[model samples]
Target: MTLSTDNALVVPHPLGLDYHISLQTPYCILCRYAVRPGEIIAAVFGHWGSPSYLAYTLGFSFPTVAQFEYGATVYEKSRSTSYPWLFCRRSDCYNCATLHDTSIYHIDCFHIISKNTASKRPSLRDIWTIASWTESLPKTRYQAPPDITLGAVADETLIDDHESILARVCSIPQELRDIIAQRCPESPAWRLVSALSRWRIFQPLLDPDIEIKGFSFDDIKSWCRRDGMVAGSGGSGKIRIQLDDLGVSRLDYVNDSPALPTAASRSQNAWFVVEEVSEMQEARIETKGPFMRIHKLPSFHLWDTPVPPDPALTRWNREITGNLRILRIRSIALKDITGLTVFCQHGAVRWIYPHHEETFPGPYSYPCDNSPSMAQLVPSAIESSSVIAIFFPLAKGEKISSVWVRRCEPYDDSIPDTLAVITTRGRFQLFGKYLCPTRPEVHFQQLSGNNTATHLLFQDVDFPFQRVSYFAAVSASVNNTGISPLAPSQLAQSRGFSWSSSFCYVSIVGLENVELIWLFRRQVPEGTPERDRLCLGMMLLYEDGTLAAAGNCRQGPDIDVQVIMLPGSIHYKISHKAGGVAVECATLDGGRDAILGDEEGWQSIDMHSRSEMRFWFDDSRTIWITSPST
Candidate 1:
């Protein structure tokens, strides 16, 4: 017998396993209390008639039946002193299941209510509606219309086409053929069903008014006969017809029906028609814009300069390649430092880390920690360096002490002559150490529009001096003609020199808030014809992003920033503040110079060029030599 879609009963019990089984078969019970709706119970032993069954067969009153079910009985008593017969000692509650059992009494009445509850059944329409609404869907069915089309359907061909897939299914491997057959059975063109199943793909079609009529297996067979090709004959004299490529191509068309338009599709004037309600339910809306949102700008990678090797410069060549290692050190003392200053010339200014202990630490002093506070530079000019002078501040009763320089070898081993010792009357005896530079290159000062010209002075030495050479160029930034001050003969006052250690000074004709960092190196060692050791130089910080650097010779893995040429004039304004410090700057043409304006304000710095700047802060004390005129 065929299962009717309607009239399908659903047991009310949450777990109705036994009740379902009983519906499928038959069973007997002892009494109403013998079993629950969903519980399993054994049949009576050797008894064909149960309590209720026996009552129905024996014509007993409801109360009699109930008493028997409870293992009770009735008897009549004799004369006036006694009953005619012996009656049941236990009283019987009438079975409310029948009218004869009803009485004017306070009874639970729940048993009667249960009978009515059990009799109430669900209608065929309700079952069908619920099933349609709550059914789970298969994956192959489209749940929504995708913004970007699925790759599978993009190249699909019409089934009616001779070369289409329906025809090709027969030629495909048995496994693939079986998979397709299981998915799309040759039956009713249930486009609505398919559409509803793919709700995501056809959500716009979701409406109470939408109706889909189902078709029978015979109807599908006729459709297949008209469209699909009969591939072979079966064992039972039946024709085994396979959906040809042409027939399959026409399947979607045949199933097509009016579809509700999606918001996005409607805006774009797009319309579609699908066959099954399920297919319509699964329909999706497509947006015209991008499939995925793209949100940020591409980043740029900076290329590092290659380092050259020179045996003569070995003493100043301390750097770890490809590693930014963290090191621990002591904090710099303010008393042992000197020459803590900010100078401005032309349209530029820089805090110079000259021989000041805070500016440049020698070997004997304790190593100071280089941190964020020590290396911050803002309103930066070209190649700027901030030097802090540290020395022991004289105390009322404390006596001054002697200070010495410390030294070390390549392996961090102590070298007696690494630094020089000195004596002062202040309570603190140690020297100063500058912390950081602005940026790695001299690119900054040029941006501020400063002149970069310098004259160098050096010690006369022999072969080693001859082995070393120097070059200089200058930029005046006048008439929009970028003539740099770095040229060897840019200014008559500018000095140039060649020896183990060198020095030079350039004037900034134009450019504001400018700074200069001087590069210094030793080409010769003591006892030798030349003195190849570390030297000391100076750098200025600018308010603008530019920086300026000048000195004897710069070291490798240098952190000093470089200046780039621009097409404008630059100038600076310098002012002296209280406490022996000054603000040196070459802001813009008419811009005011930037420096410490008040006697009391927290000053932070830029350590952008700290790598090279750190050289001055190191214990070696040899990045720059003294100026000849000084």
Candidate 2:
């Protein structure tokens, strides 16, 4: 068959680039099942037959013309049965005794007959026979002249050429070919060609003829060491050379992370171990990253020598050795001497002494050498007119050892002068040749004396202080205040009461008089007795002189008692009396307020979530909380 010149190969689209590859067409078949092109054509023509009528008038089969139709199948079913029925069935028509649709099938049948007519053209081989010229013949014997095409050249001469059919081979160099013939006599020319081609492709890097001279044994050895040939030398341990030239020693790590020397026998010539530390002037620990390294300082000091050594190494031999002892000695006063004692009634006081000018130097010193003072004596001052008794021992040498005293300070807002006088003994120094080995204990005695005596003698004996007491009472409902019989029925059925998960409660308005008594005692005794009976401390008399009490009466639950601060120090009795519980006050400390664990009481229920309690204050001269409101 003759080839068609009109249908050339499909070239890529001309985008600005010289060569281009087309984008892959998406395969609808691969992604999902889809209707065939024939089905789609049938559906479109069957629905609208404008193109089908044109095909019939043009003498073409409707099926063949519909091949180029552009449409998609709308409905899904067996297209084979559906399409044929649509094409064959019509209003009225008969073919081969069977009625078929003429209107629909006319256009598609015309194109099918046109394609069959085009297939009857002359073949290409028949035309080639009439135009043939060249022929071939074989020679059996006799010699003939070499048919060189160029020398006997003619416009249309037929030459028997074997170049296309015969196997071709590239000749190696004559010298190399002779050498191969002598050395590798078993190899054929084709095999030799193949071996050379393979060698060029696989081992193109085989010994190139580039001259490299002037390198001696020592120079090469030194170069190898510089390139990391020494054992345990470079950054990591392993040879730095290529694998092919790596002798017999297998490298542990042959990476490019900085070469290292190999230490195996086969690599003995490849590396050398330096017994001494190398002193290079440029050797410095880089502080570029997150860490810092301590590098050996250059042996040559900058002030002493300007230029560094040639081999530039460090003295790695010297190290600090042998026993090194640290001694710590503290010198203290050998003997105790007289010291001053002070008692202040109110304000705070502090005192310090300086013996002489600082004896030590530098940053650190004993007794704070940085703060030097020569002051030898100081005096006292008064914030208010309060008594202050001070006793001091007079020391001959002035080396005072210890100072002690029992002091009392009181703060009274009524008295304008609240602070007492404070006396301080200043610094003193004793002259001596040597410190005494034996330490003498000196005692300082404080006697009852007064700086402001008149104030103490005329001051009032008692002071007014705030006192708090507690009273508790329960109600059936949050806002209700009514009392009922102490029974389950009274608590649950009464209109004045309410019920909770655990208890039924009724309002107890009259039971709000539960009072609290605070009894103060210095200590708790083993058994109950008259001597242990605490006296009435402070009558927590509200201006009315009646103690405030809180009530706790709810539901059918009886009043539960909790021991407050001390044993019998504070006690309460709850009874369902007509008017409620009566409260009283008593003291267990005779005439004094409780020192510590003594006063105990309860507080009234805080309706608004705010409650308070009060008790006598101890010698601290401040009121204490007997009970807290709940």
Candidate 3:
């Protein structure tokens, strides 16, 4: 890789008129955990970074190109792990075990910190809050490159050869690879070479073989509206991703987070349904990396057409076929999702509750770009402010029984916004947005465990496009359910708190709920006049159906006298009395009253560790039971 006199410019400013040297892309590393925003950062760095720090983070001035844009100057000679088409391929190693964020680095690595060069450079949620505090040990991943023959692709040749992966998958032809091989027929060929080098589809105006040859057959039957065809649409059950297709310094990465979340289908998959209404595009992390822009509101503009159709593929082809016939009469699959919402209309809409898919690649959208904005969330100037509101309505056969997310914050360390979830028969889905409704915040930072959510974790940092600071939800289960031998004497026995007396404390934080669908008790109305009156009030439907209170109940949700409906996989034990309100009991399954429901008495843990959940209040208000937290 030593051939890089380091000019890495792709569009590094100065009237970027056909400038060159981005050796067909690789270095997107400014540490966006799952990088892929703007391109250009080539890094074959032998003499080590600093071409004026890529001209002050790519601003301009490299003037000297009498027409140049060839290729193959990324110094070849065989370095392994083939780095293929990236706009998404960063598997976090900020808690470095060998510096692994292939979005390249070295302007003083963590952005200049020679023991402290005027501080401030953390953000990527401050290095994922110290890499979510302590977690490097996974080491032993082949290792090798401490310089045996002193590498840099010692001579370079493995661009995953075969005429360079067939000149990068025949520039997306074979009719856009049979329309992206019928929308990912069991992906891998890094999902068709990272969706044809991430829709840069050899750019001749986003080439579908030179400006879409009218993709025909209803754009490959409206982007493979499911049927059956999984065996690797590229043939021979494709796998190919050994790494280094053209530099990601020596690959092997993955401590987990190889990347691929949204992009169900699209070869113009009929913009699915486009009335397109979303606008906030403030943007930061800079250098062409965050354009969630898609301004095209008032559509079809009162047609007076004589002969005009292709306004970017026939103005959404008849309203995406009337929204795919209203998504086939709302037949919503993916188990009809049920709930998951994220407020802020003109620039954030985490939809998914029957409104399942038409596009969902949040945070400055990147299910591999081409955006005409079909609602890819994350933009907030405080319009709706409802952190993780709804997806509420669900009755017909009602079945999402449970799934969770609540990280809350309006005080303390600040910037967490708020979130929450529940179901089986409606009336609880209140994670956020329903026309701007959000007013309860007694502190709830984490919970997730009533199943059905293979994955949905938006911990804040939107790629290198940072600053959205909050939105947390984590759920994964069907087997392994450990922890709760009453967790380390219930977080080291503070279940009897006194933190040096003086009273007035409240921390109802259910950090990692193991399950509990509903229970918003607010007692003392028995025979009225307050029966023996220590009159406790309560609220807590966590594990997603966030309904706070418990210490600050304040007679709301219509005085919740008692709404007990538990069983999100059982294991409840909440005894209360934290300085006032008074909640005495919420028992089930475990064993300070029988909790360990088996699985070898559970204690497995290791979910990438690092967990801490707080909730302390005394006057005998000690509710205790645990499922997650290290």
Candidate 4:
């Protein structure tokens, strides 16, 4: 029989009985019997009367019908309690009643309905049945085994042009790849791998190559020395090696034989040699037969005359291989190192190195004729002195060659306090001293060849006539005739051509309340134009003894004295105060004005003991200084 939303299905017993059974509506069943909506129909069995006949037609036994009644009663009671229940109906077996919102049935039939829905009545069952079904199902799908038949397949054709080759190499085991990477980092494959390896973030991926076994600090030093590289010990015992030219071959030897000589040689030699043996064992051989043994002898005996040394190995070799000359001295403790100098006379350079523990008995005389060659002056000027300077005469027609130095003595001396030399080509060679103790720090500045004249000024300053001496070196170059010591004042005033000057001023500002004033006058050549021809500057002394100089003073007489260029002359006035010092600059043509220190302006400088100051000016017309009393 078909059932409608508002109709109940009635069926007569098939045993020729007159009695009929009718399912009640859900609402009436719940109200009259006080049963849950889900278990309402199950309660109708109480009105069935003679359940044997109804049960026989439905294929259920008498005891099963009683069990259904008992289960329905328990489920309805459970709805009143806090526990949840599942309900099913024969007509809508797929739709099961849920605890929340009875109108919304549970669509997952496996979770709510029994396996044999036909045998059991649509009534509430045990709440544990839902959980039992869930446990019976598998957690995940079954996985198939990998195909071992698909061996190492070639994927080169599948890789796009944009794909990185290093990424493919990384997929291989790192243990096998690391050895190849470390041993030959210059290989094409390694270069590509290293380029991509830089971006790896994990520690395991970074520098995967193992450390080389036999590479040591001594090996590194030997390689550097052979290749003319720089190797030295740094702070905290760290070693730093720098290769100026990587094209030079590194020294690699095995058993007194050169290994990996060059890229070309390495390719031909197969780079490395390997030996394989199935077994290694000690063996001894004994022979009883007499045999004649002959040994090859040298062509000449020890008593024979020895061959002469090669001229190329001698100190006076004259081959003009290159124009660069280098002189290096290893280690020596020369007290008067400042007195050393290399003078270039005619077309040769001369330098002196005294023997160990030997002192000059008297002052050595230099060549009187400045243009004399080494052959003419060596015998007359330096014959008596044991501290004779080594002379290197250039080729007869060659210009003065450039001289370079690798290493020398006075390792802690930064500036070479030696005499300057003027080459025959009219170029100046400034001496440079390095301060590096573990390594060489050579400093060489090529002087302009166009400079016609150069001036050397040695000034000694002493405050309060103290015994402590302060020496300052100032070099000035001009495009005019060179000046002698006696005619410095006259040369300063001479003006025949337009000229430029460069000078450095160094001074130690004493602790006393002395007003240090510096006066600079620009000496314009007589015929030169006067528009903006003069510039002035002042060096401010810091409490730490370092100097800071300001140039082109244009602003005001500010608190921190501002420097300005006046047409005639400019001077710096420094006064020592209690907490700080005051500096002022003014033109010679006007009355002096005092500038007060302020926050936005130049703050007062703290005065300290023996504060030092230095100023360097370049491309100036002329500069001079004046000292003042405290």
Best candidate according to TM-score: 3
lDDT (Cα atoms) of all candidates against the true structure: 0.21, 0.19, 0.25, 0.22
lDDT of 2 by residue, 1-630 (tens): 122322212111122111111001000110111111232112111101111211111121222214322211111212232232223222121111111111111111112212223222111121111011000000000011111221112111111121311122122444554454444322233222222222222111122232212211122221221232223433332222111111112112322421111112221122211211233223222111111111232231110011111111111101212110100101111123232222212221122212232221234221111221111111011122221222222224433321111111131111111111112222211110011112122111211111111100011010010011011111112222222222122112222111111111111111122233222222224554322332212212122222221111011112122212211233322212211222323233321133223434322232123233332221112222234434
The better-scoring model by lDDT among 1 and 2 is 1
- Candidate 3 lDDT by residue in tens digits, 1-630: 122223343213333222222321222222211112232233311111111122122222211111111121222112222522222122221111221211232232232222222333233322222221111111111111111111111111212334543245444545565555454322223222332232221122222243212111111211111221122222111111111111111101111221212333222111112111121111111001111111111222111111112222111101222211212111112255433333322122233333343333234221111122211222111112222222233334444433333222353122223233445543333332111112244233223334443333332211112112223222334231221122111212232333322222233334235233223333444454221223233334445544333222223233344343342232223223222222223243322223343323222322123242223332233233233444
Candidate 3: regions farther than 4 A off = 1-40, 43-338, 341-393, 397-413, 419-426, 432-461, 464-630
For model 1, what is the error of residue 177's alpha carbon versus the real structure, in angstroms, after optimal superposition? 72
Over 1-630, each residue of candidate 4 has an lDDT whose tens digit, in order, gives 221222122232333222211111111110111111222222121111111112111111111222332121112212122322222223321111212111111111111123223222122111112111111111100011111111122123322232445336545565656655544333333322221221121112112252212222332332322433223311122121111111112222222221111111211101111111111011111111110000111111010001211112111111112111111111111222211222222112233321211221122221111122222222112222212122122212323222222122343122223223333433222222112222234222222222221211111110001111111111223322222322112112211211112122221123223233332223334664322224344433223322222222112222122233331222222222211112344433442333222313232222322232222222221132233221
Steric clash count of candidate 2:
39
Question: What is candidate 1's lDDT per residue for 1-630, written digit by digit as tens?
Answer: 122222212111222211111110111111111111223222111111111110011011222222232222222122222222233333221101111110010011112112223222222222222222221111001111111111122121212233533334435566654455445432111121222122222222233354433332222322232343222211121111111101111112222211211111112211111222222322221111111000111111110101111112111112211111111101112233332222212111111222223322233221221211111221111122222222111222222122222212231211111111122321111122111112121110111112211111111111001111111111122222232233111111212221212211221211233343222333332353211222333333344422223221223343222232221221111112211111122223322223223434322222221112111222122222212222
Ranking by lDDT: 3, 4, 1, 2
Q: Taking the candidates one at a time, how many backbone clashes does each contain?
A: 176, 39, 35, 3
Regions of model 1 farther than 4 Å from truth: 1-630
Which 10 consecutive residues of model 2 have the lowest summed lDDT? 133-142
TM-scores for candidates 1 onward, in order: 0.14, 0.10, 0.25, 0.17
Angstrom error at residue 362, model 3? 25
Output candidate 2 Cα RMSD.
48.0
